[model samples]
Target chain A: MTDTVMTEKSELPVHMRRAEFDPVPELAELRDGPAIARIHTVVGSQAWLVTRYADVREVLGDQQRFSHARFLERRPPGMADLSDEEIAQARAGNLLAQDPPDHTRLRRFLIPEFTVRRMKRLEPRIREVVDENLDAMEKEGPPADLVANFALPVPSLVICELLGVPYVDRAEFQARSNRMLDLSVPPKERTRIARESRAYMAKLVAKAQAEPGEDILGMLVREHGDDLTTDELIGIASLLLIAGHETTANMLGLGTLALLKHPDQLALVRDHPEAVEPAVEELLRWLSIVHSGIPRVTTTEVEIAGQKIGPGELVVLALPAANRDPALLPDPERLDVTRGEMGHMAFGHGIHHCLGAPLARMEMRIAFPALLQRFPTLRAAGTEPGFRSFNVIYGLTSLEVAW
Target chain B: MVSDEQLLRVRADRDVCIGAGMCVLTAGAVFDQDDDGVVAVLDETPEDIDAVRRAVANCPSGALSISTGTPAGA
Candidate 1:
């Protein structure tokens, strides 16, 4: 056991690395055999990184063997001082932090609202949201940070409307959301910001409890108030608020930059409206905005790609490698918008697959084409867009673009 | 009349559906969403069986399924 620990320790680099916009070069080497690597995280923890596509699916698909709730066994290392009450409050209703029965229960309630049929009803409203952002960007003229002016606001407003959070509260929540997902932010600060965000949602939840609106929060209050507690409401609202925007916003920013880099592909998406849907898929697969997914812990000793992972061990899914795996797609690294039937794990896989995927996809399908059509000569400004490397969710902080 | 095994019947598991909507995107004729966005089966024997199969495969939540036991005359 001592020798095994030493070997694992030696395998890790001094500072564990994160993937960039593209799949890391070393990942290709790691994918072929012994697909697991010992890696460090921003939180200063070591995890077994599952690099190969098949292995990632195997690990993520089997929640019983690789438990999402195992990480909740203790407060984060620095957060050990947090009281049990505080910890319980933190975990309250965040679905990603849960396993089976609990996760399934909460998810079942929200599923109806997220169904493709439901999102289709939302498309017209989502389209309006996209167009309004585009109009503002057009008026703002060239040299605007796409991330700020366009990418962020579209989803931000859509989610705000969905949750019945007053649109005026966007800046406050956006700030808290940013800090909450930022790994570079000190853990204490992240925790504090998280608390603030939840408190803000709690206020909205209280209001919804008193008088339910035609929004998701309102619907939950009207329908499932008996089943759900206030903490759970806040947790659900907070997760949706943060997740609904941060991911799709990044995809918009990074996706635009990626398209600009590949004009041939961009032309197809711009000129052919039908191409938008598939382009979104290719972009989602290529960019994979979410970095290593929510880490899972092994409930039992398991072997993946001939490498053995012991019980209670943490496993990280390298999504970019999996999406670009030759086993999943031919010429896996190339950005082919026309590529049909690309079954990538960008939204993840299994029971925890992104609930807002349809909404995110619809937003993109509307936003990208509208942006291109509005600015016929849209191109990147001289300023290089800043990539958020240290953040838990990968995306561009600001992308300067001009027409 | 098609054999029972050959009959294609599609159903949406409303409880488990997270509404990724890949089904409607793949086979719109066979699926539609209700007012709240829960999937409502539009047609059990869709005009395009291949597209229906593709939709079933792509549904992220496994909310969609096909059964062959139900006969047209039953």
Candidate 2:
């Protein structure tokens, strides 16, 4: 199932760099030097980059001061303008795009579906899903691309089953979602792909509207159909699909590679059952996959790290940099799963935290242990693992591994 | 008189809670969420202060706060 490693080598934004363990020097300079930095973004003007852990925490905690949905109102220079209706449509049921009470109303409908206890109920099914992929990879024998065979498909199928997305259309939606996030691709093209994604989701949503199934989509339709618009439904379903697809897949691929690079850590995660949770936490902190949650707009005059910014200035918090800041832990550079450090903004912070966090955590906790237990001889296949450094989320396009 | 540090308690603002559920994942004894995903402070002064601290630290909404010597939810 493995496609070749992606070799696309476009320049990464200043917040990101090509590295395995730590956020590289580009962001390290920002985190250490000052409370705030003015960084040039690919799609936007110069924005304040809050990389210090404390400062990022402060900005993320107070939505009154740093509002992300407000920032999108004034689009970046190169982007096409969205009309009032278009903007509303775009923000509808989009958790990141809408602030409360709209965001709260939308998120509340889906929260019961993703609670920790609810996710615990999905454990057996998740184990079965991980095992099914592992079984397929085993049947195919050594030198398999873990990204395609295991990392990508496990989460893809889980979300598909849960979101009522057809498994057969995984290829189409995966491609669209991947390209939608690929920064190397033209913005216009990405927008086109995004529309196609919404359209595809709209069909599934329509079917759910007519006859709801037991999937999360069905639950939404049955419970909150009257409360939500069809567009909002489509937006919500499609957002989950894209978010679930690669965030963990990349973490799985890149995490496996990171552990493989550090055999001692890999052994601990594989051998000790108690080690799994901390290992996953460290991997998330170390990888810190998603670049920044979103660009936040200061709603009023603010003081972030003593830099008084006027109202309406754009603010971006670097999760990768914040995770690796010395203030987060004593030595943030090392991938020490045993560090017992828990607060990594890999999932972002404040009202806009990652909704799929529990689900992501469960999949990794199950997949990593089972993969190692099944194939203790697992080693990186000679092929160099490829990383999607240019994407919004940092991860490997392919991780060729063999048992 | 007991020192303020002798007591540990946690408080959750349901209005501010975004239902991320990190609290339960981190310190289930101290927190849960209602049906709509507002945080439910289970044992506000549970013995697991460390776990509650982690939950407070990891919470995205900053809905949960820990203080010493004050009863949570008072």
- TM-score between candidate 1 and the true structure: 0.90
True contacts kept of each: 0.62, 0.79
TM-score of chain A of each: 0.94, 0.95
Q: Which regions in candidate 1 have their CA more than 4 angstroms from the true location?
A: A1-20, A340-342, B1-19, B32-42, B45-47, B62-74
Q: Residue by residue across A252-361, what tens digits does model 2's lDDT show?
A: 98899988888998899999999999899999998889988788988899887777888988888888888888888887888887764468888887778889999999
- DockQ of candidate model 2: 0.73
Residue-wise lDDT of candidate 1 within A1-403, one digit each (tens)?
A: 1111122322322112344467557666676545667776556577787877778877777888988888875678666566788778778788988997899888877877887667778989988888888888888878688999999999999988987889897888898888888776777777778677777888999999999999999999999999999989988998899999899999999999888989989889899988988899999998877767788999999887777778988888888778878898788888888874536788987778888888898899999988888887899997777977767678888888988
TM-score on 0 to 1 scale for chain A of candidate 1: 0.94
Global Cα lDDT for candidate 1: 0.80
Model 2, span B3-64: residue lDDT tens: 76466767898888888988888888778988777799988678768888878877888788
